[model samples]
Target: MDNVISVRDLRVLDGKKTLVGPVTFELAPGTTTGLCGPSGAGKSTVLRALVDLLPHGLTRDGHLEVQGRPIRYGKGDSGLRSKVVLVPQTPVVFGGSILDNAVFGLRHLVRASREDLRGRVEQALKEAGLWKEVHNRLDTPAQSLSAGQRQRLCLARALALEPAALLLDEPTSALDERSRDTVEESVAALRGSRTVLLVSHDPAQVERLCCRTVRLEHPETMALTSTAA
Candidate 1:
């Protein structure tokens, strides 16, 4: 199969100042790839650039493609984001039941019947390693879930879309050690079935979860390096 995502000479800029990249990499189908570097190395920034979610006033430049079609800087709209779903470092749960949170994107992006959407949500929750814990209480308030559960819930939400690739930005940074382990298990389960680009400051975590890694140099150096795990 072809690469799920391809990026080359990508850069994020604020006016004339270069904030991130000139980085390049590819995510093959069903592989877990890590993006890792020290703080301020623009690891998170690169993920944002990939999904065209850079903060206001910042812009991206370079070659990006999903399934081989080029994505222009400003052309990465809802359609692009749907294919390459981004799960931010912080988990965001809307006001509703757990099932509601999981099916949020599907309700907007897919024109499926309620039963079909429910089935997809169930599958997503399972893939995220969250179904066993919450399947019985899907109608309960989502805010009641613990931090790690909330994070997995967010992952389930992204998974429900059946995205071409998933961009995870420091998904475990905010969780406690135990929670981190749980989330890692969930990520590990995705290895051979999902295309994931994980951003992490913890090298050990990257080593544990990713098959290979892309290392970003300090902002001053502006270099992107890669190695197989």
Candidate 2:
């Protein structure tokens, strides 16, 4: 498998709290990797460190790469961040129409043609299992939608950017059973095409979507493969 991301002895420290282990893992293209750890174990931080979104002077060590390219650290690499979108635990739906929220940042940060935008947006919404529920409500304010809808909307928003990799922090944690199923389906479909790193406490969910699993015990500990577990 072609590797898209690699973390070698990655260390991330924020003041006195170390957020990442000397993590060493490689993400092969088109495979899904599930990240599991105790709360505050820095599963999210590992991803953020890769994208350089940690607090200023957080201090990151070791080598990281993405899509065969070094994950360029430092400032002014906004474009790189776009290629590796991170969807947090909370759903972030803006106050505007759902369509606007989905395509809002894309218009300014993304440079796709008008035709491409329409197709990709529709595809993402459909893939996210939101198209049927939102087909006629594209112009409706996202606030009018239910919380579950908003969560799916965020997933759609991330998918709209055409990211090569997606970092998800419990993407289904805030949803109901139905909404959770939608997220699971979306993840199942996403695994073989995009490099996905998901931090999930749900073991069943991890087994459903992940090809491999890694558990981070503490900041100084090593990333242990759970595929053998």
Candidate 3:
């Protein structure tokens, strides 16, 4: 299968000190790959690096490509990010109705008529496993949703972009068991259709959701980093 994203010798540095990477991995099309490691292993940092969203004062070095195209640090990062959506650990909902939140990013990124946009949002909602619950309440305030529902709402918002790949950062970590199950079901549904890179501390969750796994660790006196599957 073709890879949606590939990284070779990727690393983040803070004024000459290695903070993350010197590791490599590939996300294949339509496959869910789990990124797991102990705390402080830079799992989240790796995700940000993929999209060129590395924090201030952190610089990346390596070969990074998306859909076979090289991703320069500042050049076209926004475009690359739009194509590969990232859903952070915390769900962020802007002030608007549920429908507004779902269509927020879409309106700026996708050019379509109102009717067409609505159609796309509806499909995305269903894909994110949120359609049935919010179908009639789309006009309602988005802030009214519970934590679980808000997370799903965020998922739907990302799905609306019809991205080539998804970078999920601890997607179920903030939810209760029941809510986690629901989110897991939604992710499982994307297995054969969407390429996903899931970051999680829970071995069981990774085992359940990922077809392959990449383990990252602190380099600790090593000159190079390696990834294991």
Candidate 4:
């Protein structure tokens, strides 16, 4: 497997609490892996550790390399927010218009021009399955959108980066069934090129999407399951 990411003995600790592993896994390009566990089992924390975003007063340990090199702090090697995007649980819309929120991250691309950015953000919106509903109202506040719309906007924001991988933490927890399907369809489309790591409690969704499954039980039990019938 052409591994896009490799983690060895990954550990994350927040204050005095051990949030994630002593865990290890590799994410190969063209594969989707699901991180399955009950709430507070540190599923989200594991994703955060991958991105070096373990919240307030948290620290990470162990070897984590992206693309092929060690991610050194500061100098862009460790900027997981850019290379490894995360879509948190619930709808997290930025304080801006729909277009603004969607295009927010694309502005950091020095090689991309303004027109290119606008065009690409719109394209991402369309690809996220949320274009027509908000295209005419691109200037409207992002928070004004429905829960589903907001979630789609977040997906668009993550896609704006053209990230090497995406980490989702309970992405469908707050959506209606229809909205959930929309997001799942978008995720479905991302397979086989866009590497994805998702944390979900829904067994049906897990069975449907993941190429592999890793179950983290409490702080000590870890099982990696293959997608075999």
Candidate 5:
């Protein structure tokens, strides 16, 4: 099978300075691959670069391909992003009920009837492992959910788009142990079905969740190592 996403000599630059990478990797279809490294190794930045969400004034250089199409640099291509969604390190919840949050991204990207949209949201919630808890209370304020649920809700929102790949940036970084476990289980369930690129600073977490890993080193070294987990 073809790779879902591919990066070759990808690097992020701040003015003339290289802030990240000279890293490369391929995300195989239906597999969970970890992008793991120490703090300041630019794991999260790599995720942003893939989706064309790099911060202002920063630019990415090198080849990026989604499915098999080459992505042009310096373009904020909405279509590219829609196919490869990024769920940030911090889960962001907007003002609304649980149902509203789940359908946030889909409402804009998809032109479908209310029933169809609801059906997709329902399926995404189940994929995120949040349906059982929120199905009956979808109308309730999303803020009522705990920290981990909020994160999974963000995941559900992204999943509703039916993106070709998911870029998760330190998904469990902000949760308590129990909440972290819950999120891990949700991610574990995605393996072999959903293409995932998980950015994690926690080696143990990567070990438990990823089939293989791409390790990023500091900019000074400009080296990346790939190994099976």
Candidate 6:
């Protein structure tokens, strides 16, 4: 399989402090790789760097390539983000119907007729394992769904974009046990068809859902300098 994302010597800095990295890994197409580490190990920070979504005052240095093409940072690369989408930990629901939230990102990212848009949303919802639960209530308010459902809705929104790779940040961390299982099934179903980089602190979850795992550790000492290699 081809690598959808490659990172070498990736590091995140907050002002003069080294908060994360000098980490390296590759995400192959149609595979799920877990980014596992303890809190403050910069797993989430690494995900942010992939999409150039690093928090304010934080800067990153590394060689980041997506789909074998070098990503030019500081270019406001929304297009790159569309291709390798990031679904963050918290499930965010906008003020709208379930259908509206599902197609929220798709409508702006792709141009299509209303029927076509609905079809895409339906497909994404099914892929997210939410169709059977929400299909009859697409027109209902999005806020009415449970937390796990909301997260899957977010997943569906990202899936609708048809991204080459998905950066799932602790997808089940915020969910209850039952909800976690449901979400896990959704992620497991994508094993051979989607390229995924899943960041989690749960080793069992990683072992169950990921084909391979990349372990990250907290830096023992801050490095003042970094190399792209």
Measured against the true structure, the TM-scores of the candidates, in listed sequence, are 0.95, 0.90, 0.94, 0.90, 0.96, 0.93
- Give the per-residue Cα lDDT of candidate 4 at 66: 81
Candidate 3 residue-wise lDDT, 72-103, digit = tens: 76565667768888999999999989999999
Cα lDDT tens digits for candidate 2, 112-158: 88787877788889877889998988898899988777877888888
Better of 1 and 2 by lDDT: 1
lDDT of each: 0.91, 0.81, 0.87, 0.82, 0.90, 0.87
The number of residue pairs in model 4 that clash at the backbone is 0
What is the descending TM-score order?
5, 1, 3, 6, 2, 4
In angstroms, how far off is 141's CA in candidate 4? 2.8
Q: Residue by residue across 142-206, what tens digits does model 4's lDDT show?
A: 88988888888988888888888899888888888998888898888888868899999998899
Off by over 4 Å in 1: 219-229
Across 1-229, the per-residue lDDT of candidate 1 in tens digits comes to: 8899999888889998888877888999998999987788898889988888889999988899999888888854669988999999999999999999999999999999999999999999999999999989999999999999999999999999999999999999999999999999999999899999999988889888888888888544543345554
| Candidate 4: stretches off by over 4 Å | 14-17, 72-78, 109-111
| Model 6, span 102-171: residue lDDT tens | 9999888898999999999999999999999999889999999999999999999999999989999999
Worst 10 residues of 2 by lDDT: 220-229
- Root mean square deviation (Cα) for candidate 1: 1.6
lDDT of 5 by residue, 199-227 (tens): 98888888898988888887645444455
Stretches of candidate 2 above 4 Å error? 15-17, 226-229
Q: Candidate 4, after superposition: displacement of residue 118 in Å?
A: 1.3
Point out where model 6 deviates above 4 Å. 220-229
